[model samples]
Target: MSTGSFVSAASVENHGVVCDCGLPSPVRRSWTRRNPDRRFHTCKGRRVENGYIDCGFFRWYNQGDPSGWQFLALLEAREMMEEQRMQIAALTNEVTTLSMNAENDVKSKELGNRCEALKRDVQVLTERCIGLQNVLIASTVGFGAVFGVMMLMWTSNTA
Candidate 1:
């Protein structure tokens, strides 16, 4: 059986086996190409702050390799899991991009509305200024005419 890659077996009962360190070994499963689902015993060690330290004990739980059909099924299952993980990652990226685009679209629309409102305000202010200027010119012309009439009346009384 292959010994390159192994994973911890979940919910596996202990087999009353002890290593050189007098610790009970835990059952694990291999994931290598040669031994896809082979179970074995590995030293159960305490976890330190950095990592786990083991007694370097190892033993095979199963007698022989799995049949041809079983090996093929395990390989196929592993491939399917990898493909699903890749698909999930791609979908997550797509969702994030779409969310950002939606936010930018909303901000653009708000800015456009603000620009239009400012333009309307400027137009209203310009119209009011023009109206005030016309009123000032009319008042100035009326004052000039009143002054000319007063001067004519004064000259006639002096003569």
Candidate 2:
């Protein structure tokens, strides 16, 4: 393909390996559905563009046009990649769960702190109410004693 991302370092090993070009033959994978995973060596300058230039240098890396071992290797690589993707998904889920738990803990602690503050306020208000009740009782008794003394003085004068 025109895209070079699939190019392998193994391709460089083919440099001067067996090419009549006496130069490198970069390894390239076939993308056609007919031979979906086949690999081959071709001239480094071969183009799949409008020019479609080729140096007439070609060789199949897979034996007998399609090798059983190469197909197995491709399957193994796909399986390994799938396993890694599953592992990453599991780790991501764990991180999200841990984050939610941490948030819950912080919220719980804040609620407990607010409840404690309210309890202290209630206690202070109760103490002030008791002090006010005591003051009212004392004032009532003083007024009653003053009234009794005034009645005694009126009866003594009337006698």
Candidate 3:
């Protein structure tokens, strides 16, 4: 990646550097491994969408590349950045997994509670059915005893 100020042709006219295509060159910084952060000027012309073409002008804006120690430091910084990015991705995945697990746990608890409530309802209904059956048995027995007594009294009167 390179960084630089976008100087228009008119703005850079005072610098007296112009490309073969009659356009003032723009100053840019290089971020490659060989020239990390070195500044340079290149042609302002760019290739059209139909074909590749440019003035191919190039010039160094800075005098020299960084020292050996400076280059090593840049490499270390790049590696550290990559490691940090990987760590961030791993943490993000863990958070998503934990969130899903928490949601499932809540749902499971709710289902368990609903099951208990249904079981209680069933128990109450069974008890009510047993009570109704007892009442029906008592009613039938009482009716039979009353009818036998009436029949016995009428037969004795007739005799």
Instruction: Write one digit per residue (lDDT tens) for candidate 2, span 43-155.
Output: 76545667655566778766555547666677677668779999999999999999999999999999999999999999999999999999889889888889889999999
- Provide backbone clash counts, one per model: 0, 0, 0
TM-score of each: 0.79, 0.54, 0.60
The residue pairs that clash in candidate 1, if any, are none
Tens-digit per-residue lDDT, 1-159, candidate 3: 234532323224325667778777777666665666566777767679987577888777767767788788976876788799999999999999999999999999999999999999999999999998898888888888888888899999999
Residue 15 alpha-carbon offset, candidate 3, angstroms: 6.6
Model 3: residues >4 Å from true position, as ranges?
Answer: 1-25, 29-35, 40-67, 143-159
List model 1 lDDT by residue over 1-159, tens digit each: 445575756345668977778877777888876777788887777798999888888888887867788789999998898899999999999999999999999999999999999999999999999998998888888888888898899999899
| Candidate 3: clashing pairs of residues | none
Q: Which ten contiguous residues of candidate 1 have the minimum total lDDT?
A: 2-11
- Better model by lDDT: candidate 2 vs candidate 3: 3
Error of 2 at 99 (Å): 0.6
Count steric clashes of candidate 1. 0
lDDT order, best first, reads 1, 3, 2
